[model samples]
Target: MVLFVVAKEETLQKPMYLLLCILAVTEIGGTTCIMPKALCIFWFGFKGITVDGCLTQMFFLYLFAVTHSAVLVIMAFDRYVAICDPLRYTTILSNARIAKLGLVGLIQAVLLILPLSLLLRKLPLCANPVILHTYCEHIAVVKISLGDTRVNRMYGLVITVVNIGLHLTLIGLSYGLIIRAVLRISSKKAHQKALNTCTAHICVMLMSYTPFLFTALTQRFGQDNAAHVHILLANLHLLVPPMLNPIIYGIKTKELREKTAKDKDKGSNDKAELLSHTYSDPAGA
Candidate 1:
């Protein structure tokens, strides 16, 4: 639905919409990486996955996750430009530039996560082959490995800290500036309007990161935590954002709502016209 709307609607050809389209694709890709296998395990009792296959799945899962985070950072920048610098927003975030940003996000994720898979390949798994979680996760895979995982752990920590920290920092900075700019407006209506534009993105960003943060922290620090809780949070971290993003944005964004309403009205009119024509020609038939 998001792809169709963004592609067909000329009014949605701006950088904000382009970013949204990219985000939609990222969400779909991220969920696709894990959901099918998860459903297979749940419904068909097919839980066994080979080491190489698990690694592959983990790679794509983290790749999509990292890319999603990077995309959120880009979105923060988008909102920042839209709110803090309205006149120069177009100049700074042109279509080509937005496309480039999307590409960069994907590329960065691949580069950062590719090494983890390579490291996984080196680890010798002597423990039970069964993964506790629904899908293959990097930490879970590494934890089960018997080989020296010092390098993998160090690298994983670095990547997590750097990737998540950088994204959060940039988003925070962008929102800080946006808030400052928004507060400068004397009119309460203008202030509300400007903040309203950012509200959806803010919700999305929080939704995207909060679950993962809790899960990661708990996995690392909480020694007495339940396995089911960890698994649940991990799955939710992957599934919730993709499923809810379109609905949230559609409800929060006026343009999307208007477009949806227009499409519905057009369909109704077409159906009515077809019914009228059919009735009118009944005698001829």
Candidate 2:
């Protein structure tokens, strides 16, 4: 909400602000669309899939999947700018540049997940169709398909490799640079602050990525109530980070706190201006 308002005005020139907005929007989509669909499928079961509904759910799942993955990539880049190129960080991660990266991420996500629909669409639903967890996840949904899921399995393998491999590569690179930067900082305070920032990001990444990887591996290896564990972890992966991000940033970063204060000031000023303008005519005279 604050990001939306900050982005609306011209004064907020911070690159990180735009990054925050991108993160917020992406997480909102993940939480609202992906989480709910997964939970609904797990809890209530699918409501008689029409040919259209299946396709629609699949599309939304695709959208959520891509956006979530892309957002992680975007964040890795953001960290890179902040740590690796602090001097040119503003120019490197300008609003336009961030917007472009975000678009590319979104596009990449969409393209990557498009195959899932094609691969899994025609496969027959299983007999004992109970999603172990609270969501209709890509893998869980696919697990029960009676048809030859070799193609689906292959595509899933590709997605797992690409998504995990790419995002982890970028994140690893960013943190490598970040660690160097932190080490170079003479001030203990500065080093601690840098470590603290990345700590939240690292925690989020662990929570988000670990379950997906575990689930994928377990499925391939003939796992058990691991599905139930995977489902619980999956929900936590989606829910915990998003809920934590704003709170952590708000509490830890002085810049964000100041910006929030300034935003409040700006709001008060705007309300004052409106009141003055409204009564500034003959009534005031």
Candidate 3:
């Protein structure tokens, strides 16, 4: 649906839609990195993965996760500009600027996760090779390492603080400004409309981050929970946002809904034309 919007809708060629497209693609990438292996484990009983393969999966899992979070931060900024400074939004968040922001997010996610792979490569696995979860995760893999993981832990902390902490703070601050701006508007209808515009994004943010926050907190502090519970929340955090983001946006955002409807009508007309051409007589009967 997002791809369709990008391809067909000329009006949606703005930065907001471009960011949404990137986010949709990123979400797909993130979930694909883990879900296939998870399904194989469930259906085919193919649970074992090579160490190098595990590391690769871990890299992509964190890469996409970090990228998605960064994208959300960008989105928060986008919303802030759109709502708080509507007149300057076009000039501020031009296509080139949006592209740069997207590139930065991609690079940041890659650079942050790159060190994890390098650190994992250095660690000697002396514990049981079996990974309890459905897919490879950095902390899970690090826990089984025999060598000193102080540096790995420290780097992990830094990564979490930078990626999650910084992004969340920025998002919160963006929303804070957005709220302040919204309140300044004297028209209640405009205020409501502006808030409505942000609803899908807020939902997507909550869906994407809340479960991950829970899982991370549990992993760091709540050790008494069952392994299955941890795995379940992890899977939810990785999978649910991707699955729900489009749905939430489609339902909540008027433009997306209208575009989808237009696409459907266009598809139907194209199908009808194809049928007419297929059944029409060669002799112009």
Candidate 4:
């Protein structure tokens, strides 16, 4: 829905909305990587995944996750540009530039995760391997495998620190700068307006990252017997942002909200007209 609305709505073709569309795609991919199998396990108790399947799941899960983190940082940058330098926002965040950033983020995810996947592939599994959790998470899979996993654990730790830590730092810096810029505005209305623009973004970032970092830490350090707690945290990290981002954006953004309302009205009018015609002229095809 976000992608379609952004593509068709002329007013929503700005860099921010474009980023939202990319974020939406990442959310879809991230959820797709885990939701089906997790649900099947919970509902039908069918917990089966081959070695190849587990590797594939691990690759995609982190790929989308890393990509999602990058997008959040970029969105913070977007807000920074819009707030700190309104006059040059377009020149600074041109469509081509945003595309380049998205491409770089995807390449970064591949570079970081592909080697880890290869390392995971070399680990030996038992005759009947069972991940102590719902899905074949990278950490869970590594826990269940035999042989030295120090390299895999080290690589994952480095990736998490570099990817999640760096992104969080950058986002924090962007917001700090944004706050400074907002404060510099003299008029009361202007300050509030600038802050208002960032409200939805800050909320979304909190929703995206808090559970994510907690889940990552839990996967690495939590008690072995608390697998269920870890599983719930992981699902919340993967699932919540995607569910709420659209709602937050739609309610907070004037242009998107109005566009959706217009479309809804148009659809209702079309439906009513079709029904009226059918009732008035039943024999007419």
Q: Which whole-number lDDT from 0 to 100 does residue 70 have in model 4?
A: 91
Report the C-alpha lDDT of model 1 over 158-212, residue by residue, as the tens digit. 9989999999999999989999998899999999999999889988887888888
How many collisions per candidate?
A: 0, 5, 0, 0
Off by over 4 Å in 3: 276-285
**Candidate 4: global Cα-lDDT?**
0.89
- In model 4, the clashing pairs are none
Model 1 quality (TM-score): 0.95
lDDT of 3 by residue, 1-285 (tens): 887787678998889889889899888898889889989999999888899899999999889889889999999999999998889999999989999999999999888999899999999997557777888877788888889999998898788877898999999999999999998999999999999888989999999888888888887677898988888888888887788899988899778789899889989999999878877967654
**Candidate 3: residue 55 lDDT (0-100):** 92
lDDT for each candidate structure: 0.88, 0.71, 0.88, 0.89
Question: Using Cα atoms with residue i matched to residue i, what is each candidate's TM-score against the true structure?
Answer: 0.95, 0.77, 0.93, 0.96
lDDT of the structure predicted as candidate 2: 0.71
Q: If ranked by TM-score, best first, what sequence of candidates would result?
A: 4, 1, 3, 2
Quote the lDDT for 224 in model 1. Answer: 93
* Per-residue lDDT of model 2, residues 1-285, tens digit only: 557555665666566666667767777776776655555666886544443455556567557666766777677778767776778877777778877887888888778877787777788876656544455567777776789888887887898798879888987887888888788889999887777766656666776677667656766664665556666666766678778777666666566677787788999999999888878877665
Cα RMSD to the true fold for all candidates:
1.7, 4.6, 2.1, 1.5
